[model samples]
Target: MKNGIEIMNVEQTFNGKKVLNGINVKIEKGEIFGLLGPSGAGKTTLIKILTGQLKQTEGKAEILGKDARKLTGEDYKKIGIMMDNFGLYERLSCFDNLKLFAKIYEITDDEISGILKEVGLLEAKKALAMNLSKGMRNRLQLARVLMLKPNILFLDEPTSGLDPATVDAIHGLIENERQKGTTIFLTTHNMAEAEKLCDNVALLNEGKIVEYGNPKELCRKYNHQKKIKLHLYDGQNIELEHDKSVAKILNRYFEQGLVETIHSTEPDLELVFMELTGRKLDK
Candidate 1:
């Protein structure tokens, strides 16, 4: 199967500092691939190189089978990109903003309206971009990308400060786009976001990939132990180690009426991130 995005020993440097060093990654077509890292970890630099906004200092990247640096205007029509720094025109109405971008991408009016509705912004079509809430602006940014119906999308920190419900809505939009055969490349520090949306993720730190794999696989690989939390009726919370011997003990505790509500705790993406990066993800 052909890959949607391929980076071959890509490297980048700025002011004599290596931001990316011999990076290699392959994003399969139709899969949501994530780049997980914190600020100043070269995540934005990598995205810029992948989207042809900046040239790699060494090696190469190919998007949709064409050298990323060699992409032309026609090639851009097949790609969409959203980043935190790229803001919309605050003075323009949402409808006009989408229409203008669609014109730039040579997308039809019908496609623009459809994308607006798809992102749940149809009712706010005529609302000025500045008048919309932060979450709404974020959704509009996504809608702008969808208007082109690009085969590949590069999203950087797609959900940053939004509430959980809005974040979930954005995730759903990404899923919807993926179902339509769009290949999504997501970059975010939010481990939960990556775990919820990406099929596979690469952990980047100091401008290099430290780990790469399925979220579940990485979590299981890094976490050799499991734990279970017991919430007692008397407001006492006790944690039990999960092992063969502990399993029997837990069963006996329940059988003897000593246990309360029990819940198993597995290693999540945040744990995996810490294991790989040697620092907590929330930090």
Candidate 2:
């Protein structure tokens, strides 16, 4: 809670329904912290509160020691947010979109082209925003956010609906940003993307954090059993649960020419989600 962005006991209610109940998180500088949750799980609401667009009914959210609810003009200047609903003007060219955001973020022309090229939109600079593909538009949105040269980035579903290639491009850009000392808070339903890019992740269920830790740590914690799978020379597949005996047996099998291929199996994030939350990410 002392470093990066902290949200302590944050709660929110909509009409008579309590959406977020005592939600808390502390994201560190230069770390890609992922908020993993299904749709309608209050991810967007929490993001709104953190960005000062909405007030929490109870508790507090802070960024770099500044109260999230009372963010100053300078605070806005240092944070970049790319949400699902942050619209791009249909009439503007991709370059113009970045140009407008550059003015808003007070960045100079000297840095705009570099940011565009970094996000792979330099080729689409003259294309109308409305004419871009969905993936291209998403990249343009991210490019617009980076125009601020912000220290902290709040991204909601950054790779949603993008093709595998576009997703790779976006992930590379995100890694590049983190390397440059940008703190990223990402909310996504894409568990694979989260596992690949996040340094730490929190599983949010019904607006509360059900679990939080490094992805590998969580996987090890939840996986009560491990299996060793092997392909035999006779084209038969064999599986043995991991144990001291299994290890010895596998070594002997390999030496006896009985093993062709082998792999160890542990529960993945999706399996862990079902074990912990009793539901799939898409559900």
Q: Once model 2 is optimally superposed onto the true structure by TM-score, how far is the C-alpha of residue 88 displaced, in angstroms?
A: 0.6
On residues 1-283, what C-alpha lDDT tens digit does candidate 1 reach at each position? 2549999999999999999998999999999999988888899999999899999999989998999999898888888999988989999998899988777667787787788888889899999999998889999999988777789999988888898888988999999988998999999899888888889999888888999999878877776667888877677888888777887877777887866698777688877777677877545
Per-residue CA lDDT of candidate 2, range 1-283, in tens?
Answer: 4437998999999997888999878888888999998988889999999999999999999987788999888888888899989999999998888888778766777688888888898888989999999889899999887878788999999888889999999999899898898999999988888889899998888888888999888888886778888999899998898887897888889789888899777777778888888988767
Model 2 ranges with Cα > 4 A deviation: 1-3, 257-260
TM per candidate comes to: 0.91, 0.95
Clashing pairs for predicted structure model 2, backbone only: none
Per-candidate alpha-carbon RMSD to the true structure:
2.1, 1.6
Clashes of 2: 0
**Candidate 1 displacement at residue 255 in angstroms:** 4.6
- How well does candidate 1 match the true structure in TM-score terms? 0.91
- The Cα error of candidate 2 at residue 280, in Å, is 0.9
